[model samples]
Target: MTSTHRPDLPQLMIDEAVRAALLEDWGRAGDITSQATLPAAARASAVIAARKPGVLAGAGFAESAFRLTDASLQFEPIMRDGDRLSPGDVVARIEGPARALLSAERVALNFLGHLSGIATATSSFADLIAHTKADIVCTRKTTPGLRAFEKYAVKCGGGANHRFGLDDAILIKDNHIAVAGGVVPAIEAAKAFAGHLVKIEVEVDTLDQLKEALTAGPDVVMLDNMQPDQLAQAVEIAGGKVLLEASGGIELDTVRAVAESGVDLISSGWITHSAPVLDLGLDIEIA
Candidate 1:
């Protein structure tokens, strides 16, 4: 993770997402409570703070929510996306029209909490395998419409992204094997269809399939649901000719063993799909 250089989430990328979220929250009525109670001229200062300790992500998204809600709002960062947080640590400071701040609060925190959750979870898995050559990567099993955002969060938490979508790389899964009639044929089809720049990966469930996959000269082999010993054996069988990825039911306790088994990458869907939301809130002060 590069701390000094924060990852770039361009305005174009964030604007659409943040705008949609804000629109969802606003609906037809548009923060009726704020409109009914607070004067349009009201102004205040607030701080986005951590309610629990975790790694941070989504600084850009959170900022986008606030600014897009009301252009005059001043959002300043005290902490970057990849920074570690403790309870009471302020993530950012905002000063703006009170009603605009209030209206944008939930959308901003939602992005922060959810993305930070993924980042924190990825960090946990990354910590265990740091000593090994393996890297923790996220699967494409991400929340709909939020794949790019979630994958970016994975990077913030010190994990790598597998593929943004099916278009980037060709991963021939077991179903693909069944469709193509066999492992060799699936690999053959993928190789024939893939362009020169695209890498081909095949998912194999057993050592026998691993043997078959290697003959087709795949760039990577996903050893799905295999035990650590089996993975070690597969690594030996490949003889470093193909990159090995151990994926399936990888949790914190077993990740180290998988890493030690000499696989090059460890991927899981849990980090993106099921990670608990990081607790964060905005503390406001009226001006």
Candidate 2:
């Protein structure tokens, strides 16, 4: 399969933000322990290891953290971004002055742990539906200022991305339904207003609205909170006329069943909102 490359603007911004945060934490005085305990010329080596199984991401940013702190530091990567790692797997090896290593440790681990958590969660859902044709996707429910990095992590975990923002596609939801008076009118108005280059998707809560949305010929239809049986029936009703998306209240245990219902896409919001950070730590070797 051909891999799609997304622009790295998000990753770059995240790196800058993380570096700034590290500086904020350090202040002008720097780490007191490292400053006093270790000699100014002290050098050390260390490895960043995962304590639990997870999908790895942000190795680049993690490396950048150390480099931004002290350009003389050297980082040797054992695994690249998007690599699946088990407990005790070393992701990167670093050697630098003790003060630089100690100062950059938390900042680097924070990015790896957070991003790996998102990737791991997304990968679990993607793995659940391996036998099905439906694609696992993440919603806009992402960390503020971390959307691009989080979405990239999702992709790294084998999940696809939905529209990046309001600009990418016209998604007419329940509120739009109310504003346009009904599913048909909402879809029609959206189609009329959208440029020929844009695709329109409409969200419908019930089978009745599903019928109406189909009649209006939307490019995609989101079946919100519908049961698996209902979704199967909806898929039948759709009859391949429109792409069917199953969303809302999806958990890992229920994802495979939803995918089996023959929907074209399954979107989960929890992958970003609720995934726990993976356990990763940077241990410096005392010499």
Candidate 3:
């Protein structure tokens, strides 16, 4: 992932997110169960161990949760983001007041598990297409509040990020074409209104539409749900004139074929939205 470079995360955003999650979990009662069962002075050591194989992400956020719960809590990450993990691997260790450790457990694991899942899912696609020039990319279908975290995980998994939002680039989808009355009108309107730096992309469903879109001079063209042969034909049609992207119904088994069809990028929403959480558990090491 990015030549083994760790994903660069914004510390302030991570801290703010952890605090919000802690607040949501704690509520006004503030982990009443932990407070009742544990002595005020009780302390413990714990390790976050992976129960399944996956790539790691969001270790920083997990540490932030513990530190936010109790300033005295000390958390050490043994594995950095984007590292490959195996079953029973110790990702991190923590030592702190018993109440705080127990109180922060869920929020910490939630981030660790969810982000790791995104990384692992993205890696599966990236790994399959490693032999090709195609790059895997994630779509906007992300968790509402956790888009940044999820997109960061995609990078950590060797996948590129699409435009962060609609504001960053001009993408004329099918409906946009329909509303603008046709591909030419949509492209003309976008070219007229868009900023100089914004790159325009248009989606086409058939070869005729691709021909029309090519004539319109978009920076990139997306071949939506095209079969391998059709994609190869589209590649020949583009003939290195513009970037090509293949999207729709992309899964682990079919991604390699799609990539091998000579597309520049393959975008999928499943990696972020449908990935199952990587199972992880924090167990007390000592008490």
Candidate 4:
């Protein structure tokens, strides 16, 4: 088994939510097919293996699903979060009642596969910028309630995380700029209104606004929708006066170019919002 410690606090809450979701999925009688076809006393053991190469994540959550279904279930993780695996690599091992395993299989695989996918995608972006000082980060475009888990997966994949919510950091976007009249006014208002502890960041779509944002001296500046040449120019203009973040139009193909532009951080919303779920399965080994 992997020696990495399980995430106690967040994992416990995730377990409770997974259990509730499983309960909702399987009501009074539980999985009807397994109950009808499999004997109650039947025992099974199985291995969770990767069918493709990717980073591992959420193994604990998958184990939680099985344990929540049957406390007697024994789960041994073969890999830790952030561990890169190849096709046919075993991720985890499970031994438990056949019915319990069958009932929990989908929920378990769902969490594991979804999170692993996010981690894999995030890792790709991180790897692209490995040579640069820029850090790959995820934005607030997450799957609602699953943000915490997804962000955790991003970290596991070697990426940094942006603010968790609106409360943590002050981000002044275009709409806020429009409401406040312009970039300078928005940043000025933010600087005046924000607490001393809060770091204020403003998004700019053009070099003119970038110039204005720099004058306001916000903690961070987000360069939105700027081309690679424009980004390099913006970075040069900023001259390390404040942290520069590159956002918008980031994809697997174009990300490396963006990272090479000398920005401090590269934030992509698609890694969490649009990444496809990894293909994984839990097959029973009758014993």
Best of the candidates, TM-score: 3
**Model 1: residue 107 alpha-carbon error in angstroms:** 0.3
Q: What is the lDDT of candidate 4?
A: 0.87
Decide which is better by TM-score, 1 or 4.
1
lDDT of 2 by residue, 1-287 (tens): 21456324355676687778788879888888889899999899999999999999888778888888899999999997778999999999999888898889988998889889998998899888989989888899998878888888888788888998999999999998998799998888998899998999999999999998999999999999999999999999999999999999999889989999999999998988898999999887666
Whole-model Cα lDDT per candidate?
Answer: 0.93, 0.89, 0.93, 0.87
Candidate 3, position 164, lDDT:
84
Q: Pick the winner on TM-score between candidates 3 and 4.
A: 3
As for candidate 2, its clashing pairs are: none
Instruction: Report the candidate with higher lDDT, 3 versus 4.
Output: 3
lDDT of 2: 0.89
Residue 148 of model 4 has an lDDT of: 89
**Candidate 1: which stretches are off by over 4 Å?**
1-6
Residue lDDT tens for model 1, 1-287: 22324556778989999999999999999999999999999898999999999999999888999899899999999999899999999999999899999999999999999999999999999989989989999999999999999988998998888988989999999998998999999999888899999999999999999999999999999999999999999999999998999999999999999999999999999999999999999999654
Worst 10 residues of 1 by lDDT: 1-10
TM-score of candidate 3 relative to the true fold: 0.97
Clashing pairs in 4: none
Tell me how far the alpha carbon of residue 180 in candidate 2 is from the true structure, in angstroms, after superposition. Answer: 1.4
